[model samples]
Target: MEKIEKFEIYQRRFLGNKLKVMPLIEKIIESEIKNFNSFCDIFAGTGTVGWYFNKENLQIITNDLLYSNYIPLRAFLSDEEFDEKKIEELLKEFNSIKDCEDNYVSINFGNKYFCNNNARIIGEVRERIHKYFLNDIINPKEKAILLTSLLYAMDKIANTVGHYDAYRNIKDIPYKPLKFLMPDIDKRKNQNNLIFNMDANILIREIECDVLYIDPPYNSRQYSDTYHLPENIIRWEKPELHGKAMKFDRSTLKSKYSSKEAAKAFADLIENAKCKYILFSYNNMANKGHSRSNARISDEEIMEILSKKGRVKIYEKEHKEFTTGKSKRGDNKERIFFVKVKK
Candidate 1:
């Protein structure tokens, strides 16, 4: 294995990741708000926005339904104290693991989402991680950091088109040895950071911050379906797998924002939000692709819901959307609806 430095959370290929437009988002917030000490990313998919702001020393509160996203968010943004030197030593041990065991990941996902060898190793590593946590070898924060490293490593070597919807059909899947890298995060404890694995709409009412950034799913695609493999690995429930895609039941994790109820959900979220400013990210890809790929909430509905809250200003930047080789590509612009909340 080569001497790798560290893995940035943005390095992983995630659907709807805000890595490219992060600068634009920062600019909009910086220009609009004069003073804000806390930022809440309620629909923090990859924790990209929340993690980015954490670097700037703003108190960050992040919420996502999936444990896959929650674990990484905790790793990157949690202020809990951890031993960096011990974590580094554990990374070396996790990477040096050789003996592969036939376990849930190997039996269900072998030769599909991952190669046989890597799949077995993945199961082995996950089991070890749980054992480490169970026996008090690592704290919750430390466990998150370790699990995050495994998740990123799996994403890199998965045999799919940047998602877990389906794997490529071939006689032999590509074999890449499973390895862990240190998650690129500050060793110093971040201040006043909070993490949640909860539904965004329900969560919005309970949380308050200076800036509430909402980047809900724009289309009908459920993140649980798109990233189910990662969810399965992160949860480790080992439930029954179904279909060629090898997904477990994820009914509870579905977001209403991705359904026909998007407008209603958005309205409720806005009505209950307690914040000085609202930054809503929605793309102009309505009715552009197949029915499932089309945007659920309409522009009129968004404006109507937001107008009741406060004065709204719109910002636009042309950006390409991530597709799973199904949706049609066209002129798309990611729009941010910035609103000054009425006190």
Candidate 2:
């Protein structure tokens, strides 16, 4: 039985905005919190923070723009318990699926993201999973678990540094067999949890919880651009692709936090947050040199927006920023702003 943290291992390698300060968050919640029964993770990237609260007996409502991320959130946050034997049998059935020629990934991604044979195998596995889903061989949750497992497996063997931006040259590509692992989902009974695949700004309006956690994109790097391959896999949408990256049309998934409107967007989120306490996780990359200038929102803007909504207390911790082996480390610090909303 692998640990639940293994699910986040691959993501931590690339994704920058992970909740590494969860212990600090818990400490704050214990010290200043009056009453907290539910939590809403508006920018639930990998559902790490949501899972943390869920374990502490709080009902979790999590949302993310990426379907790839939503899959794991659905699997982990749901109260339904799955049979280990059933899941194991299903994995065996999926792994037994023979590689077929000329499928979606093989035809499109062959010799690009993976070797031709591996791509064909990936296509074969994905097609089989969908077939099981359509034929009612598996329930919706079961399907999500399987698909997420496959996505994680594919990510391990992908021929890239971490993201799907570019693949390694043919000669450098690793030749390893694809494998899947059942996600370390919590089996304990929980209160009904909700999961959504929508923009954070849009989702904040419809739900009210005791705590709202926001960890939006910190820079111009659109997550859809970085993890497009996994998105394509989970969506199974074989849309027209462009450039050397083979990326699909992601016009609708762009975040305001990654553009010139970031400050306004942050302000809007704080103003509209229908929660008692809003805990925001952002970094201090804007203070660094221009070469390491990835942050779209400045420190002053964050304080200005958060202070207007409630009594804001800021916490900071030193952390390393993720880079592509190009930029120098500029004083990186992850900050958390706890806003106690005015009644």
Candidate 3:
């Protein structure tokens, strides 16, 4: 797990929650990247799939809806140069000012997390870093790396069931990797990779690459709902705050990506994917099927959609640490769809 460990944020992200499909993703990527020259991670959550190509000197194009994700993709996967001293200075300044003021950080999640200090420090630091990023006050690559590191750090400190809900169970645990989170950041951000913050629907045939890895949310449960505080913390905008800082109006609801229309749209999007190989990561959750929300879709429906466009193969792996209760583990077996065509 050495290589996997290097992607620390990926594992930290699933702290107490369940995410069994990550290993299957590793398997397919290991096999596919062996022959590919470039990759396009359409829904690049955490940009873990793109990391596999970095060693090959291959170009990786990553797109995500959250600006928070763009920072890491640009820093680790794309950029080459950096300014260590400036980042260190920023880090020092951030820590020095961390406890002085609460501002947007505390307003968003001070009460939800057990580590109130963690949320407060993270908010202040994120805002300061973004100020440098937005005003072109510092090197873009440096800002990206700093913000990315901070995100990792803050996530480490956050409590609750992985997302933004208040921790009902109080655990006397300390956030490790504090040094990495509040790091001696760089001043110059790497810009070798192309990154964008946009709705997933905008992707089309024009974006070309050797492989496309799609990991859109499978169920109606929205990420914004679970991770609302961080959304505000990362954005640092502190928009008219509401109940628990949830910007519900701005959320890309489950209807947008979990509807019958969404399934057809996903098929159309995949068929038009400008890649030789396309891998879709999804689980048999409620509504995953064609009939209803959280309703699992059948393989036949998926195969029929892809048959006309390319060759299709299927794989399945049981999720790790699934609840033993018969009702819980029933839907834990996740499935992967590998659709490829000769280019």
Clashes of 2: 0
Clashes of 3: 18
RMSD in angstroms, all models?
1.7, 2.8, 5.2
TM value for model 2: 0.92
Worst lDDT run of 10 residues, candidate 2, spans 1-10
TM-score of each: 0.96, 0.92, 0.79
Whole-structure CA lDDT of model 3:
0.60
Q: Which tens-of-lDDT digit does each residue in 221-291 have in candidate 3?
A: 55556556555556666677565434535545333565556667776776677778878766665432322
lDDT-superior candidate, 1 or 2: 1
Per-residue lDDT of 266-321 in model 2, one digit per residue for the tens? 88888888888888888877745453256899888888888887888988888877
Off by over 4 Å in 1: 1-4, 187-189
Q: After superposition, how far is residue 311 of candidate 1 from its true place, in Å?
A: 1.6
By lDDT, is 2 or 3 better?
Answer: 2
lDDT of 1 by residue, 14-78 (tens): 88899888988989977989689899999898898988878556789999999999999999888
